[model samples]
Target: MEINDLTPAEQQVWRAFATGAAVDFREEDDEDTAEGAQWGPERTVRATVLRALLLNGPQEPGEIAAVKLAGARITGVLDVRYGTSDFAIRLSHCHFDEVPLLYGARFRQLNLSNSVLPGLTAATLRVEGVLRLTDCRIRGPVRLGGAHIAGAIFMDRAELSAPDETVLELNHVTIGDDLWAPGLRAEGEVRLNGAEVAGSIRLNDARLDRPGRVVLDAETLTVHGDVLMRKVRTRGWIGLRGAHIGGCLELSYARLSNPGDAALRASSSSIGELWLRKGPPMEGDLNLRRAQIEVLVLEPEMLPTRVFLSDLAYTSLTPHVPAEHRLPMLERDGDGYVPYAYEQLATSYRRVGDDHAARMVQLAKQRRLRTTRAWYGRLWGYVQDATVGYGFRPLRAAVWLLSLLAIGSIAYALHHPHPLKASEAPHFNPVFYTLDLLLPVISFGQEEAFAPDGWYQYLAYALIITGWILATTVVTGVTRTVSRQ
Candidate 1:
């Protein structure tokens, strides 16, 4: 039925809604709540009609949330502006149209489930009951500023938006978003999982003070445009499990405190961040699987892992600890942050636990260290070859003869340690092992002359005889890391 088909009284309330006066109940002055909220008999009835129209919007405009309640049972959009009254509201199976709702109104108890209302918009919103908008299509900026929904407010699979220069602003509100209260304090679960937003949405400066099973589990809050959140803060675990955020997602001064495995997994999308502050679960994994991060953002010192891939782009690992500041949150109160942000990605498939991530991260670090040492290793190798070529040129023939004999003797000594005096000395016992391995190595000079038990003994004895030869040889072979610095 059309909105005009309602009763005479319903039409009056509907006209009030058109004029942004629906938030003011009946028997109330528009002057009292022109800019805010005022509760009268008419507002309560209108809240009922509003609930019905949103749940099942073929409702005549004023016939939905426009009702009267004598007991604590208040339903629909509880438009109790200023007067304080407690009521329990329950409306199931409803519909909605592009109707407007005033923002500043308080309710006692409200629930709209199994509804199909699209284009539900609100202005100075304030509710105090269990507000649930499940299976509803809200096609505009659903603003709820300075409102308190003490009961559970569920919006599962409900399409919400703030398009046409509008925004979904939930300024200062509290919900049991909790799942057990009364005819007064919304006593149930407040779930907004699997919701879609066509325009930018926000819970700017909204406080979610619940800790039971995800204070706010918005498992999939898809944003089809850029999300602007400047000074936002969350107190519970925010579940953005598989959220597809289009455009550059900016959360500059947002402080999210989800002590669960709710890492911002903005993978497979083009995204950007300003100043991000992230903390791990007091348990699970914090993942950034295949997401890209542009240079506009800097990793916070609180982010445990050094650097990670953001959108198929590999960046250098930068220390999150800035040289300027330090805070007391160095120690995590929970188990620990999952060490690897690389493996869970499409490029690297690692095991599920924290240990596996630790190993991969360590390996990457080791390779970096080794590369640094390579330059020093090259210097040492060059010097060692120069000295060997110059000093041994004179004794080439004799050295070669001695090395040949030493090879056979060392082999026999090692195989039959009982004889050949190999049992008396540890150095000669390993001589065969070295000769067997080194014989195949091709050298520039018949550096083959450098092998043999006698030469090996002479090198070992150099420490006592003069020390210069041994010092030069040992120092030339090894690159001291500290000295290089």
Candidate 2:
């Protein structure tokens, strides 16, 4: 474990490892406070540099290559700008502390993998070697393009920070191994365009912050591995415009808050969404285009909150679009996803005074399935509603009043307890006035009040009122239930 304990050959490899990773040949915009590394804070910045050479950077390859040397401590900047030494540097659980990298710093043929790399700064990097920072922090923008990393790369918990510039470019880099950057945090935009990962590329729980427009045009990029990004947070819209992914594109519980486009785009790619939340850059083919969520999709509204189907073809308005747009959504997705997407698109178009575009969706639906029931059902429901609205309860009161008068007339004729009173001085016939008229309203009350000779009109009056209430309740309940349904 001591720095000077390693043999002389191991010493050179350690020195080369330190030297190759230190000094840069290019100029950058941001000045760093990164100091040349040492073993520990107790050791001076000078002694640790020399001691690093003995542990892993051997002087001769014949000695270190022929034998196995392990547990190396590397200090200081190893400016390996095309350094000739091809050291394997394969040791698990080694510590990489405060190593300042060179500009255009290439990890070509060098392996400082499966180790702890904290407080590291590399501006422009080229991953030409098998790099493993499974739990490391390579803080800063990692612009590595056209660099062929020929071995498995592990960056599980790496933090990649970018310089303060308009764009942070990390495009077209090829990885020979599985590239993992799950839980990776980048202060600026992280671009991975034309990148090929031989193994799976996992980037779940990754955070990328870019104040301006950031493009991840990993189009034409091939990843032979399953692309995993679940619960990831990106401060900008993710662009995978024309990217070709060989395996499933997994994104679950991801939050994308870019003012421009969707948080993520697999538009031209085929993939999966076990649990996805895709909002947008106006309109693009999100995960809904390819896969289905085995679970649910959360908060699916984005930027403009609509997708336009200007490219859809139909029997009516959408007839202008190509037939491709009118086709069913991909087989594996949820049933209503595409229709909803189109629905959203139509809404957006309508807001901008595009009536024709709005009708395009309706026409497309008709072409897909012909049915008049929807329209008729609406009309039928409206008619029932009108019936209830137009019918007046006060009209029934008028009919009741007429019936009361008829009953009064009949009562006067039938009640002959007194003989013809026209000649009998109208015989104080007060019953003919109030009693007769009021009798019809209370048929039952009249019967109980007195014999046919008495004011039996009260019975009919009570019966009429009971009938009215019964009729009203029956009619009201029926109409109300129908309207609600």
Quick one: best TM-score, which candidate? Answer: 2
Candidate 2 per-residue C-alpha lDDT over 1-485 given as tens digits, one digit per residue, 9 for 90 to 100: 35576445344434445433332211232322133133333322232443233233434444433112223344445444332334443433333444544345444444443344443433345555676656444544444455566776666766555446423344666677888777776676566777778888788887767744553446566777577877776666677655656565655555566553454554544333223445233333333344222222233333234332222222112112332343333211233334444554455445556655555553344333322347765554343233332122234444654565566545654663343333533333334443433434433222333333445545445544544543453366456335523
**Clash total of candidate 2:** 53
Off by over 4 Å in 2: 1-76, 90-129, 163-170, 215-217, 270-304, 308-485
Per-residue CA lDDT of model 1 for 251-298, tens digit only, reads: 555555545454344434334442354422222223444545443344
Best by lDDT: 2
Instruction: Looking at model 2, report the run of 10 residues with the lowest lDDT sum.
Output: 310-319
Model 1 misplaced regions, further than 4 Å: 1-194, 260-285, 290-298, 304-364, 367-485
